[model samples]
Target: NLAALMRIKRRELLLILLVASQFGCIALGLVWGASWLHKWLAQSFELRALAEAHATTQQVAVRLTRDGTKNFEPGTAGWERLQSLCERTTVPYDGHLWALRRDTGALICHPNLHEDPSLLRYSLGRLPIVSSGRAPTLLEAINDAEANDEEIASGTIIVDGALQLASAVSLPGTNTVLLILQPYAHIAQAATDFIAPLEQIGWIFSFGVVGATTVLTVVLINRYEDTLAQSNAELERKVQRRTQSLLSTRNAVIFALAKLAESRDKDTGEHLGRIRSYVTILAGELARSHKEITHQYVAELAIASSLHDVGKVGIPDSVLLKPSRLTAAERRAMQLHTQLGAECLASIQKQLGDDDFLELAREIAYSHHEHWDGSGYPCGLQGRQIPLPARIVALADVYDALTSARPYKRPMSHAAAREWIASRYGSQFDPEVVEAFIGREAEFRRISEARFGSAASECDDSESTADSPANEEAIAAIAAGI
Candidate 1:
C-alpha cells in the first residue's frame, strides 16, 4: 500500500513539475516579446523626436529670413530678435536651439553663449567629431545640404562634450543655420516610461492564469486517477472469477473425455487415475533436477497423461480385451492405438484453436509409446528425439502397467517394476525420467496401493519374496509374461 501511494505521489510530482516548466517557458516567451516591444517603442520615439526637431528648424529658418537682413551683431535689435526667437522656440526632450553661420559653421547664437564666453569662439566646422565609426559630421552634413539646395541636415553630433541628435536647416537667403539638438538618452527614457507599466500588468496577469491553470489541472488529474483505479479493480475481480470458472470447465471436459476411453476396457481399473498420479509424481521429482520442468508443467502433464490411452476406445474388443498375448498383427494393431489417439486429439485441437492442455495431450498421445532407443512405437523416435512431455509420460505409463494387473499378466511388485524401469533406462526410457522415478518410487507405491486398496496389497504379496536380482533369462520371462 505504501508503494502504491508513493507511486501516485511520484506521478503527481512529475505532473506538477511539468506544469511549472510550461509556465517557465511561457514566462520566457513573454519576456522575449516585451524586450522586442521595448526596442520598437524606443525606435519609434527617437524617430518622432528627430522629425519634430527638423520641422522646428525649418520654421525657425523661415522666421529668421522674414526680418530681411542678417544683422547678427550682439546687443542689436536684429541680434536680440534672433536670441529671443532661439530662447522661445523649444525642441522636444531636453533639447536646445542654436544658430551657426551656414557658410563657415561659426556659432552665431546659443542658449549657453552668455554663460560660457568661449561658446562665441566655438566653430561647428572646427569641432572634432566624437564618434566610433565613419559618419557625416554636422558641418559636413550642413555643407552638403547647402550645396544640394536642401532645407534640412540631421545627424548625430557632440554638444557640451556629450553625444546628441542634431537637426539643422540653412536660412533661405542668409548665412544663418538654425539647429535643434537633443541627447540620445532622453529618447530611450521616454520609450521605457511608456512600456514599463504595461509589462508589470502583463506579468501579474500571466501569473494569475498560470496559478489557476495548475490548480485546475491537478484537481482533474486526481479525480481521473481515482475513477480509473476503481474501474480497473472491479475489472480485475471479474476477470479472475471468469478465469477460474473457465479452468474448472476445461478440466471437467478433459477428465470426462479421458473417462470415455477408459470405460471400454474393464481390466484397466482406474488406470487413467494412476497414470495421472504417476506422471505428477515423476514431474514433481524431475522439476527438482530439471530446470525445464515447472509446477505448471507438472500440473498440465498430470491432466494430459490421462489421455495417453484414449485411442483404446477405437480398438476392437477382440484385441483390447484379449486375455492372452497377441500375434504380431494384433500387437501392431494395438500400437495403432497411439496413432488413433493422436489423430483424435489433433482434430479436437484444430477446433479448439491454440490450447496448452490439448497440445500437451496430443503430443503425449502420439509419442508416449515412442522408445528412448527408437524401438517402441508407431514412430521409431530415438533418444532425446522424443518430446520431453512424451518421454515423461512414457516412463509413467510403463510403471503403471507393470504394477497394475492386466488380462495378459499378473502385476509386478513395486520393487520389481522399479528395477525393470531402472534397467531399461537409456534403452527404453529417458535416463533422467527413470532417475526421477527412482527418487519418487515410495510415492508411486502409495498411489498404487491407495488406488487398488487390499487387491493391490494381495498382488504385492506374491512378488515380495521374489524381489531378488533378476538375470537376463528371468527378465526375458517377465517380458514374455507381459
Candidate 2:
C-alpha cells in the first residue's frame, strides 16, 4: 500500500508539473512580449517632450550659418549675443548639452569646461548627422524619424567611471557636435522598478494556482484510491470464504475417488496417479479437437472420470473379483455398479449443491462404457450420445486394462491391444472416437507409458505390475489419482 501510494503521488506530481510548466511558459511569454510593446509606445511620449529643445538647436544653427555668422570677428558683440542665445535656452540643466562652434570644427564655447579634461573635447565623428530629427539610437534603432532628428538620439558610454546614454547635438552654424552624457543608473533602475510589480504578481498567481490545483487533485485521487482499497479488501475477504468452501469440496471429491480405486486394485502402488494421468492425457487430446470449451474443463473432466467406477462400491465383491465367467444375474449385478457411481455422485451433488460437478460425474459414470453401436451396458448410449469426456476415459480404461494383467486375463502387448481397439471401432467404441485415438496414437502411447511406465517418464508405471502380489491398496486411495 505504501508503494502504491508513492506511485500514485509520483504520477500526480508529474501531471501537476506539466500543467504548471504550461501556464508558467504562457505567463512569462505574455509578460515579456507586453514589456517590449510598452517600450515602443513610451518612445513616442519621450519624443514629444523633447521636441522644442531639438527645434531650438536646429533653428539657431540655420540662422547663424545661413547669414554668415561664421564671419563674425572674435570678441564681436554679435558673437556674444549668439553665445547668450546658446546659454539662455530653457532646456533641462542635465537634459541638454550647449556648445558653440565654427565651420572649421573648432569649439567656441562649451558648458562645464572644467568638469573633466575630455568633457569639452568629446569627438562627434562616430555620431550620425541626422537632419534635425531624432533617432532611437545613434548606433541605429530608428533612422527615419524625420522630425525626431532635431532631438536627442541614444548612445552609450562610460563617463566619470559610470555607464551613460550620450546624445550628440550639432552646434548652431557649425559642423561641430555637442555631447550630453546622462548616467544610465537611473534609467536602468527605473526599468527594473517597472517590472518588479509584475514579477511579484506573477509569482503569487503561479504559486497559488499550482498549489491549489495540486491539493484539489490529490484530494480527489485519495478519495478514489480509498474507495478502491475498501472494495478490494472486501473482495479479498469474500474470496477467502469461497476458497474455504472450494477446498472442502475438493477434499470430498478426492476422498470418494480414492475409495473407488482402492476397492478395485489392491496391489496397485500408484493407482490414483495412473488413472488420473490416463484420463488427463485423453482429456487433453479431446481438448485440442474441441475448441469451444476453456482449457480448464479438461481438469474437471479428468477428476470426474477418476470417479467413474465409484459405483463398484455398491457391487458385491464376489462378482466384481470373480476369476471365472459370471452368470447372467452376476453380470447384471456388475453392470449395476455404473448406476451406483451415478447415485454416489448425485448424493455428493446434493451435499455440495454444485451443478457443474453433477454434470461431469453423470457423463463419466453413466456413459463411460457406452458403445458406438448401442452394444454397451446400462443406458446403451451410442455414438455422439456419449459425452466426449466419458468416451475419452473409456478408451483410457480399456487400454490400461488390456495392458495391465488382471485376474481374468494376462496383460496383452501394446501392439495386440492396439489391434483389438482397431477391430472394435464401430461396435464397442465410437468410430469417430476411435479415429481420434488412432490419430493421437503417439500421444496415447505417451499417456500409457506415463500412467504405467517408469520414474523416467511422467509417472511410475514401471514400478507396478499385474503379477505383483496384492498389498491391500484401497480403491478410494488409488482412485484419488484420477
Candidate 3:
C-alpha cells in the first residue's frame, strides 16, 4: 500500500511538472506572438502613412503645376486649397500635412501655423529630425536632396515634441516642399487596440487548459486503481463534450456574422430565420426524391441559407437599402454580391482549411441567384449547373422576400407568392425543387403565417385572382435584387 501511494505521489509530481512546463511554454508563445503581431501592425501603418503622404504631396504638386503657378503665392486658389488639404486631419490615424518653403524653411501651410499666424514665420528646419540613425534635420535633408537633385525624401521628424513618420516632396516650379507627418504613438495605440483582445483570449485559453489539466490529474491520482476504467470513460466523454462545444461555438459565430451582415438593411425583418426555415422545408421535401439531400445535407443547407445574402454587406447603402427599383448600373452592382460573398467565404475557408459546411455556404452564396433557364445575373448557370443547395436556397430566398414587407412594397399574400413560385417553375427555378415546394406548400404557409402573421392581413390577399398592376410592379422591383 505504501509503495502504491509512493507511485501515485511520484505521478502527481510528474503531472505538476508537466503542467508547469506547459504554462511556461504558453506564456512564452503569447509574448512572442504579441511582439510579432505588434511589429507587423506597426510596419503596415508606417507604409500606409508614407503612401498617403507621398500621394498627397504629389497631388499638391500637380494642382500647383496645373494652374501655371511658378510659386505658392499666398492669395492664389491653389495655395488656399493646399492650405485646406494641409489643415484637414486624417482619420483613424490622426496625421497631418504641411508645406514648407524649401529655400528658407518658411512654414507655408500647417494647421498650427494657420491657427497661430505667428507660427507661420517659424522655420520647419528648426523643428529637428530624429531617427534611429540620429538623422539630420529636415532642412539638412532638403539641402542634401537639392544637392542630389532628388524630388522626394523621407525621414523621421519631431513635431510638437512627438516623433512622427515624415514624407516630403518638392512642389514643381515652386520653392515649396509638402510634408506629411504621422505620429508613432497613434500607430502603437491602434496596434495595441487590435492585439489586446487576442492577448486576452490567449490568457483565458491557457488558464482554462492548465486548470482543467491540473484538476484532471489530481482526480486521477486520487482514484487511480479503483476508478481507472471509469476515468477512461470520463475522458472520452470529456473529449466528445469539447468537440461539441467547439461545433456550437463555430455555428454561433457563423450565424452571428451572417446576422450582422443582414442587419444593415432595415426591412430584412427576421429574413435569415425565415430563409433558414423555408430552406429546411424545401430541402426536406426534395430529400424524398433526391438521394443527395441526406439528413446532414438538409441541416447544413438550413444554416448555409442564412448566408445567401451575406454579400450584401459589401454593397453600398444607396444600392442595397434603396427603396425603389434599381437602375441598370445599380442592378449590376447589386448582382456582384454573389461574387463578393463567394470570395468572402472562400477566403475564410482558405484560412480555416477545407470545411464542407463553408464550401456549401460559398456555393449557395455564389449561385443562389442563378436561374434554371440559364439567365442568372452572375454565372447564368442552368439546371444542374447550379448546386443543389443554391437551388434550394434560391427558391426559399425569393419566397421569403415576396412574403415579407419591404420599404419599397407591401408583402405579397401567401397565395399570391405560391402562384408566383408556380409560374416560375421551369424558367427561374429547378423543376424538382418546384415540385418539392408544391408538395410542401402547406408547411410553407404554416411557417409564414406563424412568423409573419396571417396572409389575409393584406386587403388583396385572395387565392385565385391575378395580381394587381401595383403588386406586379413591386414583384418586378424585387426581381431587380431589392
Candidate 4:
C-alpha cells in the first residue's frame, strides 16, 4: 500500500505544480495562441470555399439558362412543352431549385410552393426581382448574354432558420431569373461529414505526437534529472518542468514537420535522419579544418540538415520521384524545390517567432544547392559567400545520397562518393569543405570507413540500401555501435 501510495502520490503533484510554475506563462500562451490560430485558419478556409462555390454556381447557372432559352425554337410545339418543363424545374426542387420566367422578370417557382399557388403570389410580391444593393446581386453572379454566357453560380445564405447555397441565373433576351438554393442542411452534412473522420485522424495524429513527445521528455528529463534535481527554487523546478514540456512540444513540432515532408515522399522520417547523420559527419570533418567554422556550426548543420529535402514537399511527385533523369524543363521545375524549401522554412519561422533554428534552417534550405564557384542554383554564390551550414550540408547531403541507393540510382562507395565530392569541390561544392575533407583525411577515412565501411567503394548503381552503411543507427545506440 505504501509503495502504491508513493507511486501515486506526491511526485506527480509536485511535477505538475513545478511545471505549472515554470511554464505557466508559456503554456498559457501556447494554448491561447493555438486556439486563436485554429479559428483563424478555419474561418479562412470556409470563406475561400464559399467564394469558389459562389463563382462556379453563378457561372454555370448563367450558361445553362442562356443556352437553354436560345435553343428553344418558338415555331415548334416541342418548344412550348420544353419551356413549360423548364419553367417547372425552375422552382426549388427539395430546396435545390428555383425557376425564373424568361418572358417576365418574376419569381415563378419554389420548392413545395406550387401546390398552394396562393403562397407563390405572396412570395413574388415580397421578393424583389432585382435589387439596388451595392454588393454583388444575382444578375452579376449569373450573367447570361448572347455570345458570352457564364454559368449558374451558387452561394450560401440562411433563409427561414435554414442554411442553403443558392444557384441562379437568367436566359438571354428573356426576363426570367433562374435560381436554386441547395439547403444548408444537405450541404453542411456533405461538407462537414468528411471532417469528423479527418478530425479523428488529426486527433490520433495529435495524440501520437504528444505521446512521442512524452517519451522524449522523459528521456531528456531523466538524462538531466541530476541537474534538474539540483535546482533549489520551486520556481526553478517548475521552470525546469516547463522547459521539459516546451522541449517535448518542440520535438513533437519537429516530428510533425518531418511528417509533412515525409507525406510527400514515401521515404520520410528515416530519410531525414539519414541525411542528418551525413551532414553531421561531413560538418565535423569540415569544422576541424576550417577555422571559419565552429563546433556549434557543425551541430547546427546537423540539426538543419533534416530539412535539406523539405522543399520536396512543394514538388509534385510526378516530377520529384521520376525513375529517369529529368528533362531540362522538368529539371528546372525540380530545382524550384530549393526555393520551396526556403518558403517552408520562412513560413515556420514566421510562425515560430524567428529564432536561430529557423534562421539556420532557412539558410541551409536556400543555399545548400549553391556551388562553390557560383555555378549551382538558385543563386550563384561563390566561395565563402554561401552559408557554412548550407555548404556543409550540401556536401554531406550529396555524399549520403550517392552512397545510399535509391529506386532510380545505385549506391556509390564512400571512396567513390568522396571522389565525386572532390570532382566538384570548386564547381558544385564548397572548396573549403573539400579541403577539410582532405586535410582531416584520417577523420574522413574513419567516418567513412566506420559509417559506410571500406567496401563502400565497391557499391555501384546496382547497390541497394538494404545492406548499406549509409543507414545510421538510432541516436540512443549510436554510441553502442560506434
lDDT of 3 by residue, 1-482 (tens): 99788877888788879799989999999999999998998888777767777777777677667767665657777678777776774533677777888777788888766568887766776566754476787877766676888766777877778888777777766777887777888878887888899999999999998999888877876676557757889999999989979888988988998998888988888889989988999888887878988998888889888888889889999988777667888888889999999999999999999999999999999999889998886878899999989988888889988877666566777778888889988899899999999899998887777755544554245532336566677687666444
Give candidate 2 misplaced runs (Cα > 4 Å). Answer: 1-236, 240-252, 267-271, 446-482
Arrange candidates, best TM-score first: 3, 1, 4, 2
Clashes of 1: 0
The positional error of residue 387 in candidate 4, measured at the CA in angstroms, is 0.9
Error (Å) of candidate 2 at residue 159 is 99
Ranking of all predicted structures according to lDDT, beginning with the best and ending with the worst? 3, 1, 2, 4
Query: Candidate 4: how many backbone clashes?
Result: 27
Q: Write the residue-wise lDDT of candidate 4 on 1-482 in tens digits.
A: 99657744655665566455545554555566555655565445455444554554455456556545544344354345444554455222144344554544244544454465553442321232222233344444454322255344445544556655555655445555555555545544444554556555655665565556556665775587557556656668788779869866875676567667767865332557666666666677666657866877666566677777678788888976665545667778878888998998898888879688778888988888887778777887888889888887777666555555455444456565566568776777777777776655555444444544645555544335423443322111111110
Tens-digit per-residue lDDT, 1-482, candidate 1: 99788968887897779778878987898899889998999889878998999888878767777758676666677777888887788888889898887667788888767777688787775454433364666677767777988677776777667778777877666667788888888888898899999888888888888888888877887778778778999999999989989988988988898898888888778888888888988888878878978898889889998898888879888987776556778777877888899999999989989888888899899898788888777778988789889998888777777776654456777877888888888988898888888888889988877766777767667774344343333334333322
lDDT of each: 0.79, 0.59, 0.81, 0.58
Clashes of 3: 0
- Candidate with top lDDT is 3
Question: Native-vs-model 3 lDDT?
Answer: 0.81
Candidate 2 vs candidate 3, lDDT winner? 3
Error of 3 at 411 (Å): 1.3
